[model samples]
Target: MHFNFPRTLGQEDAKKRLSAALASGRFPHALLVHGEPGLGQLALLLDLAQILSCEDTATKPCGTCFPCRAFDASALETLHHLIPIVKNDRNSGSDDDEEAGPESGQIDELNESISLWHRHPYGYHVSEKAMVRTSQARELLGRLRFAENEGRVRVVVLPWLESLNDNSATILLKTLEEPPANVYFLIASDHRSGLMQTLLSRCLHLGLSPLSASDFRVAAETLSQRAQKPFAARLLPFAEGSPGLYVELLENDGEELLEEALRFLSATSDWRVFADYAAETSPGAEGMERTTRLLLFLLRMVRAYQLLKATTPANAGTRIDTAEALEQAGWDDSLAAYLGAIDAVADLQAFAAFLESAHRAVREYSKPSIALVGLFLEYEGKANRSVPA
Candidate 1:
């Protein structure tokens, strides 16, 4: 029986370590996989879950066994895959609505999400508004009440552990403290700090590093083939070391976001224009996600600008061609033009720092318009100071 792990880039060391542990029968009952998105943490957990439930011990998952087949079909009764979901108010009736569990529509959405995740674990995106509800946690506890099968292991796969609200986290903490025999919890989170310390203490933590350049290229190529699209080489620098992020940029109209970032930089000269842009771009919850993406793109651009400025003739005492720098960074013509426009007046480092802070603010659910307006105002002041009045 062969273990069927997802086709992901890099993290070979982590995988080997995990496989060894599983083989030695020393694997942790509760494992926490934490890393930046695109590092394939969820894929690792999914594979682990299958391995734990596999009826065949030699070579583990042995994808042919009934347990393995059931896992593949998402019909494994012992495998509980949990994800954050928005609660439906319409499903609420009694005061014990928390026990009512997910509505059929919600369940359908979850199943669909799981299906997509199985197909492309790295590229899958959950709704930003979705969160682990107290009711869902309660349902999980209820399911665990039944006696475990003598020889089979039950696996609870929870992704985005940081999305659990206080009540949900508290409810699950008990199970984590003393999980049923033969029950293992596999949890993944992009932001470990957002989780409770008590919860963190109960699990064996594994932190995945970013992919190397070569690994990222291979992963990108694989995903490109799967997506039936050419690799967007221009967006590679923006993705840093994350193929998941690369896939996201490829599918999420990333070029539009880049154009918007350029527009934002160009608008910084006029307060009214910048304010208008902010208001127009950030209207609501969806707008907040878009704004966050835009901010990340801008932050990357700022870093590029800093690099360019540091290597410029005036600073480095060497004539470094702007076009050469742009090409090396995989930056396009629009970005080149935007950087040139701000070259003299922008304090690249300070602006980059501000952008980073603004990004954190947006992620913490601050109003996007407010964060954008503040960012613009701050940049405007810096630009004004650099200009000759």
Candidate 2:
């Protein structure tokens, strides 16, 4: 199968710049590609990795080289797909979890990995890695321990950079600050808020916009011949520019409305609904996971809007009218509140970690519901908290 990097309409200009950089032989050692998911951000980076490592001297991954062949066979171990590293207790300083919930001592597991590529790639969900702990960061430093005699470039590709915790992120700071001879660091993350300012300054930043509604329509049609036009109309707006998200909605098995409602609440206060969703999600592991994801996406999108809009947040309503409702509901203060939402959403993983306690509470074996209610209250309170004095 052809590994197609489906370029969205507006992304061609960015591609042009990368092409120029390659042609001039001035490729930066590390590149930070920031964009919404579903824009083929990972695909572009993978293709770039091959192009960089490919023996063929072309602007693209010269369809002919050991690396290219390996890429085609999906056997290429060199292009390291680096995702957010979370800290897990099992990871007693091993580097395996770095790819999935990534941080430092995380080892990269090629087989049995939990991506959709194992079956229907489109259906893949990232396996949660434990939060990248300080030990994990040390594990990552271990990867660079050996020196390669060959000129092979092992590219580490992390899809979401914002997932790295403060301790884990510091490990990257050293490598990013210094230049390694052949190793390359290419990270693709949408959450700019979580990244360190000095980290942002260390690499070439490429901002990628999401796909247009029409573009997604064409993609959906191409993916499935029987796609309905009206479905695109409904889905495109919610994709929020990411074709992947649009695709996810179409495959949502009748929960599209719920997803949309969640998205709306995340973008705006919709205080009552969020409070209820949080309450509803608190009692069960599955419910909490789902609600937590909604909160995460909501925080991310709002943060994106916050950073991109040149004017006050009130003007950001031009994109999402719900933002205006939120502003009217008194959300027009510091970005700290928006950030709090991200932090709160991220804590759901902690809820997941304590699933046994939750299950006990759900079964009335323990007071899980009370604990959940407390968690939701904390989330709501944080959102309601204005910039502290």
Candidate 3:
């Protein structure tokens, strides 16, 4: 497959390192790419994948090979995609690959399915709903047993590798440890605690940092012609480095939700509304989950703004760059009132225990409602009055 590296944002150092690996011919078979959730990690990976699978052996893909042409035309579908899905025989979907499958049931879903993936040599996105299932893992094992075609390498990219449970991981461990000669695993994740040590040792690590405001603007501004400039720029300051996330917010129709957030913060005079939204007792499960995730994004944005403020002061007032984005997003100004000096970020680890407990509560088995409340409670109680910076 052929791909053109996105001429956008990010640290040139990262690109240099990746390029150096290619030039030196020391590229790892499996790579662990980690960093902030919305910082163009996937886009970088897509470019890297193109480089690896390119038809031209002298350099990057020539984009003229048959496979490259297919990829360029967005007609290639050679990816063996996997992800989480909760299916019951009782439901509309059946497991027969010969029949129209779930991933092929809808236009969007069909494009992400394994059939199209195997035909295409380019980007293949593993959906959040496609959990690493035992059946899927076993299928992966079976597929890898055969030799690849055209002297090409095959890749298995998992964005949220942490989602795999113990059984699935163990099954994958066997494959990861002794992968085929040309098979590669590109696993990206936000939660490292869940991954095992052996698994970590098996892959090369590529740590990603958050994108600066400039790169953020490019990533977002390019989303649509209607919305340009600083508006798409909003996501850069707040996201965890994953454009997938910013895109998810866009795809999920987050504008209304963001509006509600702004309104709720402004109307905080009614503490009940704040409490209702905070506890998530008022909204249903879907609303609660989406809103909670959005709030979490806002909180991260606030942190990013704080970091920006400490480094780059603006105006005579306390007008931090990214902070203004947070305020615009509707974070309660009262929280900022309590926000200690920028020094507080240095001691962020001091509240690790509280955060860990809350995370465990949520990841393990706590009800969504309880988990949401417990998480924020931990945050409210643990943020110290003193700033360590």
Candidate 4:
């Protein structure tokens, strides 16, 4: 049940701003933290809660304090956690909490998920299965109407705000309009654009940008040691300044996948091999995200190749300032030969265009393997004709 504030990594500016506000007693009643996926938005929310409710006035979240421990353990009576859940089609809006015996499974399932998140705030696995429904939002409003327990400030943390269904969002907007006294709401999300515009205006919006490479490196190293896994240092550049993403890629065998990607691109002329690679790499429901990850890596490589080729031969040795920039716009030294083999500007552009199309298709819910294979077929048709065979 221990946590640290300064150690939140890559969020010093944000931490400082919030800490100052808290110390000055001028913090907002409702706040929204938004950023790219895996930026530790939930962790930040919990940290702020612990600090705000901590007994030690000077040190703020003295992790050993009762309130701090409660927040860390997620056992604080004053804290309410609301998350997304799939509607039970079989039991339409049944009060699962009041349901008797084994029928109370929904409440138990929700608690178990919350427990996992509390134990591993950063590395917790969020299921893509459920969503926030209006019933849950109404439940939250009902809870807020009651006075705070233990005489402490009441705090509600709602992570993944965009998961709220339309009805849920509408109910949430009403609560935001007239939030209960001594009760504060903190919502975090990666999809700000999807949020209701009226809801956005009510909360103090805080934007968390991607971390710096130095911070990302430190975070990756820490997570690697904690998870007892090897860190792929080379993938740091491609992680785009998000340590969470770097850890994800490292855990999912990103190094090997990228190697396979390079090979696949080189052998694009062979339809059978391309199809096989596409099929194997296309993740099913649980890991369907692999497709998007693959497409991102491919885009980075293609873009890097294009930029490097565009630069003067003498200036090609120069380095970009940031890891993000280097990954997106610079070529890997080891891949120089492969890059040279496909250095034809027109050909690279064509390939990049098709890759873009494939990326769009995946975003639009297309079958990834099929979309990628189709792209390969199209490219191969032209490639075969252009070659004297």
Best by TM-score: 1
Per-residue lDDT tens digits for candidate 4, residues 62-119, read 9778877877677888888777765566755563322222226668877887786665
Q: Which regions of candidate 3 fall more than 4 Å away from where they truly are?
A: 1-4, 7-11, 57-59, 73-79, 89-129, 148-151, 226-236, 240-242, 251-258, 273-281, 312-389
On lDDT, the leading prediction is 1
Q: Is candidate 3 or candidate 4 better by TM-score?
A: 4
Q: Return whichever of 1 and 2 wins on lDDT.
A: 1
Clashing pairs in 4: 85-131
lDDT of each: 0.76, 0.54, 0.55, 0.70
Write one digit per residue (lDDT tens) for candidate 1, span 182-239: 8899998888886789989999999999787678778877888888888876666577
Angstrom error of the Cα, residue 342, model 4: value is 8.0
Candidate order by TM-score, decreasing, is: 1, 4, 3, 2
Global Cα lDDT for candidate 4: 0.70
Q: How high is each candidate's TM-score?
A: 0.83, 0.59, 0.67, 0.80
Q: Runs in model 2 with CA error above 4 Å?
A: 1-10, 83-111, 114-129, 132-145, 223-233, 254-282, 288-389
**Per-residue lDDT tens digits of candidate 3, residues 1-389?**
12346532455667888888877877898888777555555556556666666667654767777666765565544434445454434543533222223443443543455443333212234555555656667777677766554456766666567767566677778887878767767777766766798888888988877655556445555653323323443344444554446555655544554455456435433434545665654246565456555455445534654555555544324444344534653433433422332223333443444335543454454465466455545444455434433
Better of 2 and 4 by lDDT: 4
In terms of lDDT, which candidate is stronger, 1 or 3? 1
Better of 3 and 4 by lDDT: 4
